[model samples]
Target: MAHIKSRKHPAARRLNCSAAVALAFIALPGAIHAQQTKPASAKAATEATLPEVNVQGQAQSYKSDQVSSPKFTQPLVDTPQTISIIKKEVFQEQGATTLTDALRNTPGVTMLIGEGGNSSARGNISMRGFDTAGSIFVDGMRDLGNFPRDIYNTEQIEVIKGPSGSEYGRGAPSGTVNMSSKTPFAGNLNAGSLSAGTDKQKRATVDLNRKLNESSAFRINAMAQDSGIPGRDVAKNKGWALAPSFAFGLNTPTRIFLNLEHIEQRNRPDFGVPTVGLPGYYNAALAAKGIVPPSKVNPKNFYGSTSDFENVNGDMVTARIEHDIRPGTILRNTTRIAKVQHEWMATAPSGAVSDGSGSAAVARPDPNTWTANRSRQTKWQKNELITNQTNLTTEFKTGSIAHTLSTGVEFIYEKQLSKTIAGAGTMSPANLWNPNPSDPISGYALTPNGAQSKGDTMTVSLYAFDTLKLSEQWQLSGGVRFDRYSTENNNVMVDGVRTRLKSSDTLAGWKLGALYKPASNGSIYASVSTSQQPPGGSNFTLSATDTNINNPNLEPQKATNVEVGTKWDVLDNKLAVTAAVYRSENTNDLTTRGADPGQIIQYGKKRVSGVELGVVGNITNQWAVSAGLAKMNTKVVAGSATQTGSSLNWSPELTFTAWTTYKLASGLTIGGGARYVDGMVRSVSNTANAATTNMLNVPSYWVYDAVASYNVNQNLALRLNLYNLFDKEYVASLNNNGNRYTPGGARAALLTANLKF
Candidate 1:
């Protein structure tokens, strides 16, 4: 056996999509041709000499005991970090077509309705009280843009909690969500499913794989879906995606893999329900002044145009190579390029109004006194991201200590082009309580406002990590990373004035931890980590000041995470239990400076502390379960006016999720689960006034779901999924100001037919 050696190479220049694809074909001609010319005797000899190719297709149970990580060289249970894994089986059981649907099983995670609606790709997500929308990754590479993600090509989803700066450079203070893609294996396999459900939902997905030779294989996954939301009028969703992948030199000393994906979506966005009162709890005061309360309005009512639409088109390509220099050393390199285009026109809620004067106010449904206003919004943008990462891992022993070390370097370039269109549209105000849909309203027409912007960013990072076996029962781990980032933005306003903004920063991140193994199946660990996010870190768009293109003295937001956790494999290694308690402190957050007008300051501080517990795997030979619970507290310790001591918006205090499945002798399996999210403050103000407190609060809610599957034969199965089992009506998400809300869907059922060969 040969060992892989670590080496450094100059950063590769970025290439266009066509050029990259051409280069890939030129470089892999030998590998591809080898697969095409397969003599029977040669194939037999090659197969006998080559090692077996192993792939984890789909798990039979809902639980996965092990997780995959590029940064760590140890098993997940011994990595001294809090990580959660959602296997493919869980997606099939829940009939989850989108990423949002699959995320319901994870605790401490919440969705934020995007600009267009729940179905829009622009929606954000919060994890452990911090926004992590920009921290999403595919196979450890950054996934840029806000495009709706489908699970048709996903193998598993992993959530790693706490500051992960050491593993990923920059902007991972609250952790990261990584989606693993399905890949090719040396075998012949085909699987597909068709599903139909309420709300006129229809979906089909297929996975096909074939081996071209003993060491080469190709695979593809494709999906198409059309659906509508229950209880919402004219709100529909349609999308399709195709992913193709190829692997060569499988199980050999040198290997190469290529993957390409394209997705397109068109949807009628939802704007959700409106607040009862302007400030929420002012209903009584408004009612006293002759204003109608929000209770009179139905939650399912539609106030937007039927023609409003959101569209997204995305493309991604990845190439990876691995070489084994020796038995305990390996080297790998991966490159990914992606492009996404987004366009949308939405009728957003303007405001709620009523005719009232002090104590004489009396609310009514008259258009003059209570009406809903609509505003048309339109935007067109294009984004491109390119990243290349190379790493080497080696194992060695010095004296009595053994060590596993990993070193990596990465480079990323991202560019965005945006155009803005602004125009006023004619819309007749509808009565708030007794609105008539038949009322004639003028169609909206938008014109370009001469507002355009272009943004570009470049980052170079270097990282190293090591795990030392200090003793049979004790292990020590440490890692560090350095990142140099630069960004430039050029903007042209409606006034025909051009402005340029540029910023650059060099930052460092590190982590250290110690683990103690009480037994082969149990470990206890404690760790501390730190991360930072420079200005424009989230989207690479900077703001300009009068004296400078960008604020030169601005400091990056910093965060510190401290955690202690324990993991145990119970039921004879059939089930795993993990628990952790942690606290995160964020400082140097950007805020307005009251002392100096027009100047921004970095004087804000906030803290989030939580305890989490998770259990997964089989409780019995025929039963499997997955569950998690989290309790968190978030508060601003120091901040500007109106922000000090306030609670972070959308940071719920408690969340729980559970799912369990049982299989019978007759080849039938049944499962059910419930998800609960505690009410949270609707804004960062944390107002204490009784009259306004209720208005600023989001009511808590619980939803239950069930699934039943019957195996018709060795190659066929039927599954039924019941969502929102009790038809619970609740608010799913709200805008920052608490004026608009995205309501949860009503009860719906889906039936799926699955086939495998």
Candidate 2:
């Protein structure tokens, strides 16, 4: 949990690729491009117009070579980092609907329930041993909400690994997740899908694109879904979304785009099953009473009353303009405004229940007659974001060296408002063993106490990047970014008193990379990058306590990463193979290891090192595949192992995922994939340190999924997906306290008819 304030470390003070192996390999035809040394007729003018990084298209439908962000300025094979790019086609083939479903194609990522005292952060997650819910982005701009994101309008997803402050502003040390929206393309096309499956699942999606003229196009995407958990009772997910975009002067030197999206959701929230007889259950009070731990409750049990609900709304608008200054030079500007609103109410079980009076420590000897201590979570909040960005990309040669450069400036304004609520209001406890939704003594209503809080932030950032082709086989790339920002917080506490807090700071970050092309389609590379997190950077709320990490007076946390890797495109450029080894070190964590309680120090440090391997694209013209594996170790190198933030609390030692499909040339295709997550210890360090929790670990698990499709005609197809093919019972996610868990889905099936014209 340490943050390095400077861009350079002691040994790293001196420094900083093959074609990348991380993401699917498509191609980026625009932006900074490398200039060719050959004759002008040999893609020369375009080379000078292209960035130093490059790629070829066709053959492999499962691979993409470049990211949506122009900041990269190079193809994945040449970039020295661990990245995962998932295209809509991949997930669509698997019948995936939500962001969570799509992310299963990668390794080193895990889900999270909320902390002990907070409600669940529905779509929250942990990656590479750090919380990353706050680092989600869309089309290069930050998405402020933690709500579950739908992929109906998305073209592809990019999972950028390691600290990446040079690419984005203040962010999670673990990395960032970015989604690229589907936009207008030439030609008239209409596509849609209708699906039905287990748990009464029903869903539909539509995508339409029209070319009005040679210079204009229009597109729209829409989706609706209603589904229920296979094993859990009284839990369901229902939502709808629409995204529309228009483009003008697409083939001209100047082009403009207007886009917007809106989504609505209503769902039944599940707090999860209790942990009494699970692994590592040791309760002193119960043991002293000569009572043994009772049998674990069924994973299908639902603790919340039937009245529980979660409602959410998300909206976004974007405007973009792009101009070609010259054959190889392009300038672009983009602006966006977005907002998300969330409200929820749910019930959770704590321990043994007491008389309606709510007394303390009530333990019942009769396991069957025991009652659960019911607690309610109610929330109402809104998150807003506004941002503008401008960039210039151009390629040129200086002597024998060719260069692709990109520079940009950005402005952002973000806001959050929260309403405080207290008290469960006449709600009664449910039976410990089997709770009934109808057995409620309800006199309950959504009521907000006289308390509220708001946070606002304004920021401006400037950045520049350049990729240099030193020779036919050597390349160097680097970038630097500076961000200036200010934040303010206002609160109206329960006491009817108001308090105001403010913070201002500047953050500087950068990265360097070097690549040596062993072959035209392959490379070996190395890279170093840094990320910074200022006070209140994640939530935008400064704290009054000097010892708190969010205190305005505290220094920004800094994280540095070092990585080495190789990438190769083989079998006539149809298949890609990649491997990398990396170490991310965060220094200067705030801790009172040897100091007084109120006086914190910044000498603590934590580190996560790992190896990653990936393969994507077609093994043969008729066969496509994608797969990844990650192995990591997290440790509190220089702090109290049990201290919060000193080490990762939910990092798994190993994770693996894989998928493949083959077309039989008879209009039929078959594919299947597997996912494995190693046991996640709830302790700070990877060492043998026991965390303070009844459930010390979430056991490792494996899940398999299968898919098959038939192309009935040129514009029609039928696809079927089988999830949890073996119906293996396991834990999907666990809360911070480890006393509750979300169970993995039971075996289920989904059928869909795809249409296009």
Write model 1 residue lDDT over 1-757, tens digit each, in one string.
2111111111011213324433332333233334444543575577689996542322265666655555888887788888889989887788887777788778889987655321242367888878888788889988776656788999999888888888887775788888999999999999999999988989999999999999999999999988887777667879999999999999899999999999998888776666654334454445454654545357677767776777889999999999998998989999999998987877666345544434543445553466776666676778899999999999999888899999999999989888886653656766666544445546446677789888888999999999999887899999999999898988899889998887787889999999997665667899998888776777666775522213434677788999998877655456677878899998876654454342445567888998887877877777888888777888888765677778787888888788888888788888899888888786676444433212577777889999999989889999999989999988788776566677788898999999998
TM-score of each: 0.87, 0.90
- For all predictions, the C-alpha RMSD in Å is 12.5, 6.5
Q: How far off is residue 573 in model 2, in Å?
A: 1.8
Model 2: per-residue Cα lDDT over 230-273, one tens digit each: 78878998999999999999889999999999999998888887
* lDDT score for candidate 2 against the true structure: 0.80
Candidate achieving the largest lDDT: 2
In model 2, what is the error at residue 150, expressed in angstroms?
Answer: 0.7
Most TM-score-accurate candidate: 2
What are the runs in model 2 whose C-alpha is more than 4 Å off? 1-60, 116-121, 288-291, 351-363, 422-426, 441-443, 595-599, 641-647, 685-693
Root mean square deviation (Cα) for candidate 1: 12.5
lDDT of 1: 0.77
